[model samples]
Structure formats: structure tokens, C-alpha cells
Target: DHHLNPCYVCNSTGHNCRALPRMRPRIPDDVSPTEITGNGLSETEPPVLEEEMEEPIGVEDTDFVLYVSAVETERCRRGLTVAYASHCQQESALDRPVAGHANFCPGELSTKYRDLPSVLSTVKHEMLHALGFSVSLFAFYRDDNGEPLTERRPDTGNPPLDEELQIHKWSSRVVKNITRKNWMIRGGFMERTFHMIVTPRVVKEVRNHFNCSTLEGAELEDQGGDGTALTHWEKRVFENEAMTGTHTQNSVFSRISFAMM
Candidate 1:
């Protein structure tokens, strides 16, 4: 039998056509009545709403409450502590860290991001980074004599399948538990690593490790922004080839920002 998942936008109304899904605003707890217009001009202050702090749930609005309840239960079961942040406004969405170990902001623990699936995926993604896997974590590896071992190129000489498998094993449990009612996570951590960073080494590593290409090359297109950084045309040629049949070329900004975040 075929089961239907709610459409990303309009919650599968079958008639209500909207450009994007209706997202709940994660307004700051200390909001005043300053109205910010579409043109980004401020007018009057926003009225303060008196409500208890809420938990972060998945972004799909209809399922938000349910997802929150499940998340609370899971957190309880895992003995994970949660906190909230009220300062996360839409305009500053990119500035906040979704959740973290000790310094979690108010509402952050409970604030659903743009969409439920994407936010949950991001949670898992960030958790992996926290557990030590991303570029930040690569600095942790040491040789028997206390020298950095991960600084050298991984043995793509024989393909780093074993290392990739190890990373998958480490992240699988935290990723497996969240039920989205529809969304399911796929792809290994290696794939996520490739998408999250832009570097020649990461590009080559991903290509040799997973036999795939990513948007890292596209970021090379923006050269004049920073005065000192320079990109060579050889990599630019590869970037163009990687994105031959894809959409617009400005996506590198998005990919680079993702890693930086």
C-alpha cells in the first residue's frame, strides 16, 4: 500500500498553493515592538508576548508538537540535557548554533529550523561535528609519539573505505532514532563532510573516497571578495565541469557558509 507524506509546502492541502512552507517564527523572548519591514527598515517595536518557553521541535508545522514530544522523550532516555534560546530571529538565523553542550541558548533546544527534516538533519550533522569528525576534529589525531597523524593525506592510495566505515559506525546511533513521520536520513558521514567543507584536499579526498563531486569547486568562482586569497584557473576549470548541468553558479556561497557555520 502507498502512504502519502505531507507536501513540504502547504502540508499536503491539495489545493493551497504556496511558494514555501509556513514556518513558525522563533522570535526572541525579549522582543520589543520594533517592526522591521521587508526593505529592512525598522518602524515600531514588536509587542511582547507572554508565554512559557517552548521546546525545539521539527520544522514541519503540523508535526511540530509531536516531534517535540518525541524529542523530549528521547532526550530523557539518553540523559541528554536541553536548554532554550530566545535571541534567534529570522534575520539572524545563520548566526546561531542550533544546539550545543553547555551554552545552549533559550529556545534553541526547542526551536525548529526552516523545516523539520532539514533541522533534524542539521542537528545530526552538528552532533557528528561535536563528536569529532569534521575539519575541527581532524586536529585531534596523534601518532604514538604525539605527532599529528591526520595531517598527512589519508590512504586514498587504497581508498579510505575503512575510515569511512568507521565514521559511519560512530554516527549511526544518534542518527537512527529520530522518526520524522516521513523523512529518513541517508548517505554516510563522508558524504556530509564533502558537502560541509570546500578545500582541494577535501575535494580530492571525497572524489577518491566516495567517487563523487560536490559544490566546493563552485566556491572558487568568487575570487575578488578577499584581497589576499587566490584561486587557480585549473581548479576553476574543474569547478565548471563539475557543475556543467546544474543550476545557477552562486551556490558556492551557500556551501562555504554552511561549513563556516
Candidate 2:
């Protein structure tokens, strides 16, 4: 199962795949203000226009765009996999993701699976990853007011990881650590550690779901190595939820998943 995890492919390169060059607005050539204003015309007079200015080049009309493609592969033919996706490019200023790519396996596109809830859910799940619901993109997240969740490097604009193996980056407002103790039937107690998304909306939903007012935040998957860890909801805590690392027969797009988004 670890070998089949998709994040290995999604984050293969260590960075969001080579970022596309940023599009900068092209400024128009200089034009004299007086020449367009009819040579010292009075305020009461209407200004004569010499030419109409065209809209600036390279101005984007949309905030984000995702490019999807289907590719047939032997692996998909043999496995139960659906698709894989990743953010390909991101805006430099706020490190906001502006472009991504999703690759659906053509081999798995059968008529039987068409409009099926499981396949549709898988599509939505991969799209969410393409749209920044990823560990690689976590460092680039922004607050409601457009501030970076994690501090970024001035030169590279990427968040520095705390530990290469375990902790990547931490934003107290977005994610936090929690300790849990579970009593074993045979012996004493087993201690477990978890990272949680402590954002207000997510915390509210989590608390309401578990009926525990003191719950910190929603739990994130801490297993499955780099492929499944940190980027998804913990399967044990949120079984059958669409955002969990592994797909399930009865996965649902729960409110907690939406709130985390």
C-alpha cells in the first residue's frame, strides 16, 4: 500500500514541479498627457482622444487554472488506482497556487465506473490535491487576511522545514501537536502523537462531531511515510471521509473535509 501511495509521484521532485514563469503585466509605451487632452483645453471642455488604449497584456482573468489529462498506464491497469495530481505552478508574491495538473488513468475509465460515486469521489479527491490540499503546499498556505501561514525564505519564497524526516513546517494557527493516551487491555497505556489543524472552523466541526468541547483540532494522517502522512486526514479518526489518504467503498465528502479546505 505504501508503494501505491500517490504522493510519492506528486512530490517526487522535492518542490512543486518546476514553476511556470510568472506573468508580469506589460506597460504601454509612454504618451504625452497634454497631446491626448487637446493642448491645454479648459476643464469645462471634453478632452480629445487620439487613440484608445488596449487592455494590459498578460493580465489574468482568473485566480487559478487546472489542466487535466488522461494517460493510459500499465500500473493503473493492474492496480485499483484512479488518478494522481499536483500543483505545477504557484504565484510568487503570496506563494499562492495559480496552476496545477491532474492525470487520470485512461485504463480505468470504464463505462461501468462512469458517474459512479466512488470514481467521482476519487476525482474530487485528486482535484483537491491539485488545488493545494497537499503537504508540499501547506507551507505556502495563507490566512484569511492573506498572510503567510509559515514564514518563507526571502530569496526562494519556500518555507524551511524543521526536520527533514518528521516535522516539515509548523503554523500554530493552522496546525498543532496533540498527545493521546490509550489504555491497552493487556497492559498499561500506549502513547500516540498527532498533528492537528487547529483552524477555528475545523476545530468547531471536529469538536461537534466527537461531542468533545476541549478537542484541539482535526487530526491529520501521520502514517504512510511521505506519500500519505501530513497531507491527509487520519484514517482512524475520519474513516470513510473523502480526504483520507486511502480510498474507501463508502467515502463521503464530510463537512470537516470542507472546513479544512
TM-score of each: 0.21, 0.68
Candidate 1 regions exceeding 4 Å error are 1-104, 108-114, 134-136, 142-147, 150-204, 208-261
lDDT tens readout by residue for model 2, 66-159? 7888887654564455677888766667766667878888776655854587778878998888887887777677777888778776644567
lDDT of 1 at 115: 49
lDDT of each: 0.29, 0.71
RMSD for each of the candidates: 22.6, 14.0
Query: lDDT score of model 2?
Result: 0.71
Please give the lDDT score at residue 33 for candidate 2.
51
Question: For this target, which candidate reaches the highest lDDT against the unseen true structure?
Answer: 2
The lDDT of model 1 is 0.29
* Candidate 1 worst ten-residue window by lDDT: 83-92
For residues 1-261, what per-residue lDDT tens digits would candidate 1 score against the true structure?
Answer: 011112224333223444432233344545543554543324454433343333334344331111112233333333232321111111112212222231232233545553444334334433433333233222233333544333332432111223432321212211112222433346522211111223334445435444466433312222322211121112333342211111123222222223222
* TM-score of candidate 1 relative to the true fold: 0.21
lDDT of residue 69 for candidate 1: 24
